[model samples]
Target: MIAETVTAFNERWWNNFLESTNVLKKTNVFHNCMQKQETASMREDVMKIIRLIAINNIPEFGFRLYIEGKNIASKELSSFFENFTPGNDEKFEEWSERAFGDKKFGIIINRGEKFNPTLVEKIAKKITPLTEKVGIPRLGVTFTIFIGNYGWTPLGIHTDGLGENVMHFHLGKGGKTMYTWDVETYEKIVEPANRFNNTKIEEILDKANVFDFEDGDIYFMPYGEYHVGKSDELSIGLTLWFNNHTESALAKKLIDSLLFNNLEESYEILPMDTSPYYDFENFEDVKKLFHNNFGDKNFLTLLESTYRDYKMALYSNAGFWEPPFPKAEKIDHNLNFKIKIKEPFKIIYYSDSDSLLNLFIRGKKISLINNSSIIDLIKKLNSGEQLQKETVFNTLDISWNLDIKKYVLDIFFENHIIIVDYA
Candidate 1:
């Protein structure tokens, strides 16, 4: 019966572990602040980097090494493990025990979502202030227990697919260690070429920050950073990753809603072969194709209004018609300069195997024709070269087959990534 519950990826928010009030402290919850004066401010500053915050004296989080007392005879702890039945929040049920070939890889006991052990709940209760103070909305809590000897984890540098996570060591002996670097540092220190070999992270560890925690220590690492951890001997720890919303997340939320109906299966893109196939002479017809589809102001105007709806939604999400924050940065009205492809977003795409069109737009897989003309169009737009209005119109026209072209145009104009004003 349990195996019947296939775990689908959860996208909605559920972080309300406890009521939110006075969540941040001018000082530590169990001891002094790491930076006494800025302890409160650090709560907010941690957002700038991927969340990696640790403070001493978290207290009673891991009084015992495992579920049983640390001093309990090893045989006794072993006996308890042998007889253990999961409570409610242990997060391990999804995997079949044989998921891995080696038994020594250890077992992850899932206690189910409703079952948070007393110690686990205590840590979460203590953390509510920090998150509440930061003003990031919390939806719910998720936690798990890891039981194994030293070097037990996959230990490769990786990022979490779910929401934000907090790791706390309940009990362990020997060197259980964690190392991490922000996504920024990761893109620099580790060459993209060697990313496949897991050792790249370890080789670059000297350049990354290291985190060491004692029993009962609490560490918060925000989502989307590269990290890995391991212990020298058998250990037990609890991890919580709850859904949290940010301004970018809010923007994404609105965009996702607007495209919900047309959202197709996501396609992962690989690096393209840059070698050319068609001569530049072939592009004249491609140019004609784009001009015929997008030469008018009507499509551009529809695109602008759709984005206005997004900005309005953004304001309402803040419970106001205009948010206190400055206007969206990408919405510049300046049309005099050449339109350049926006920097900062990594582009990925996939085409319909049968139709041969490449589709893409910020995770929305856009399909365009597979010919050299289309490839040339994509590279030109991805490039930062100044684009004239003819260039701008053709850029949108290049991905001609996607039904959601209008939404894509709306996004380009709204975000100001595809400037139509380029002369």
Candidate 2:
């Protein structure tokens, strides 16, 4: 039998996980500030290139995609699409020939070097504060992209079964298909015992779901959910998949703590693999193992408590939103912008006399905030108005020298702290 009542299991598995993990940090705040700061200076059309990485739980579908029509229908990509198919079938070539018939490559920049330098500059400007605020090793965002033309819709309802998290962002119309199971139900469905063992395609497809997704909308489906996608249009989208082992060290530590605290006859060690262990047939045995290992009262207790703590961590983190602001050359602070932290702590201050800001982390002097005018610039930036050098200089009560104004604004432009609009 399952360890708890459906209600109890639901409490432990799905809702709790969702409530706990979705959070945006000061870095996120700073990212927003930076994005706003540069919005005016960057080319108008280029700003749409911004993609948020947090919405999806799956690492595979984590990053955003900005594709143009020409690139989607390009010869090189078309050839690649033709040469490769999702299921390694001949149909890929057949589909590829039709999709690429006459279309020329559009200007598509998949970030990094391939993207226009100006566009990159604008993005980097916005992205910097968030990265710095979050204390992530690097400010650059990374996610996978799978852009191909699947002309026909094939209904082979399959679960990723990889035991890793994934998020699907469907670009074209055929519609998504699935019967989303809540975590407990999902876990049970994919459990060693009830896995659609040797089920026929027709049988599984009957239980599948179909849904719609437009250009910017995103969906968050956590790990272990069974679903599929079919597109009637010339379909293209990005699927973010994380190979197992992406969970936080805190999560693992919590899990270990629970295991150690619970369990009747203490097992000597915990065995973990980055790959899914159960296959098609040995599920029952695996379920037996899970119950034997996890169903113990001690294990359950630890699971419950650690899950709560992790959930709390996520919930707390979610509430912390900091957008990156453009830094100004003037307005020095009593304490230096550069910080050195020996241990984790919160960095709290004021955006102004009335507004409060905070940054949380474990180490000291992670980096320097540097440019002094960033706070005032963020205030003006958040106003969502044009930020001319004169306007900034006047607001900060600084000397109206053109050379100084140009220098400060130049730094802002170079750092993507402010956006420029040519038109």
Candidate 3:
């Protein structure tokens, strides 16, 4: 049943919707494109995730709660969870209702993709054509989950981060209305300080672009638009953010990466010298230090190489900002098993120099000595075909050590780039 819905989304609805709307150029809504059953399934999956988060007490997952238009303090949330008991979904729902009374409340969880693999898989499949139309953003993609009966968005009417656009999937028990204003129009009416968190919604309603949608609908908004949403009844939404970085930002990231890779951590502190005068004689020594540390490559060359590495990792993960956590258990390579690449993920490889083959899988880079046999094996694995363990083993160069071959295979299994079935 899920497969049928996915097929419809990928083949028909998405294609037609894209043709009808200028996706990144304007704001648009598609209604009833998804089935209610699918939304229910998504709700169940998200509820399970919320339950797990409460059970484990994971504050780092970026959970924000608000009641009656006020943010809930972290310390209070910690105390609430400390005394709370996690049980079935119904228990959690009842507890929340009682704890917050009848007041409107909202829950926003960042990094939604990390918690729900099923949701991520469906989203990836649906967005494949979009990515084909507009290449993946250099900053990659991320998602945030919004669940609540909040009357108005906590942040009020505001623009997203620079170069960041959003696509919201509404999984609803109730309807939602979105209000948007162009930059010029909003600035003319609202004060500079009131540009964000503006509560004068009634004043701007007449001039705003209003979009009201129900369950199983999607809303896409381009970057730099001032917008906010209102949901008087309980609802859930997943917003996918396509983050595009400015050139300067991308350069800074590359520089940071280069520094991280080249510099060593030091805890030792250097005491201040008695003399206040600058030491001009040591300037050459500082230059020599950086020259030796960064190797013989020119600074520009190093930056270019870092950028390439970033691109490879981003593309390998299908533009996701972060890859799934690697599996914890050590793989048993000796056991016979059929292995296949995971769905919606592809292994990307390139040869920068003649002597080395770079393989990017699940956003990590692995380098092996360039060899035709190994290259052939990568192509076979990437073809999405299931192959016997022995066939994979035989594809490796016979001259290579057996341990080396096994180690290469283990990397794929550990990173979940490939799934193995013992049966």
lDDT of 1 at 35: 29
Model 3: lDDT equals 0.80
Greater lDDT among 1 and 2 belongs to 1
lDDT of 2: 0.35
In order of appearance, the predictions have TM-scores of 0.34, 0.36, 0.86
The residue-by-residue lDDT of candidate 3 on 1-423, one tens digit each, is: 365453446656666666666657778988886788888788777776677677777756888888888887878778756665345655434655766678898889998776765577678877877887778988888889888889889888888889998889998867889999999999999989889988879878998999998889998888999999998877888899998969888899889988776766655554555545775654443454353547788899998988898899888878887676666776676677888987778888889889999988877788888888878887888888898988888898888888988888888887768888986
- Model 2 Cα shift for residue 339 (angstroms): 29
Q: Write the per-residue lDDT of candidate 2 for residues 1-423, one digit (tens) a residue.
A: 776633211233334334433522100000111122232333222222222111112113222221322223233443443443223232322433443443321122232112223433333332344334433321113222333333222223335434334433333322333343333544444545545332333444444444455432234454555554434344334333333433464467667756544434534454444445654454433444343546645755757655554333322222111222332344332222221111111222232223332212111111223334545554555455564444566654254455564554454343333445432
What does each candidate score in C-alpha RMSD? 22.2, 18.2, 4.0
lDDT (CA) for every model shown? 0.41, 0.35, 0.80
Q: Which stretches of candidate 1 lie over 4 Å from their true place?
A: 1-104, 109-113, 117-120, 150-152, 162-169, 173-175, 193-201, 245-423
Candidate 1 residue-wise lDDT, 24-120, digit = tens: 2111111111222332232122111111111212112221222211233445534443444332332222121322223334324332222222233
Model 2, which residues run further than 4 Å from truth? Answer: 1-146, 149-170, 173-203, 210-222, 238-247, 250-374, 394-407, 414-417
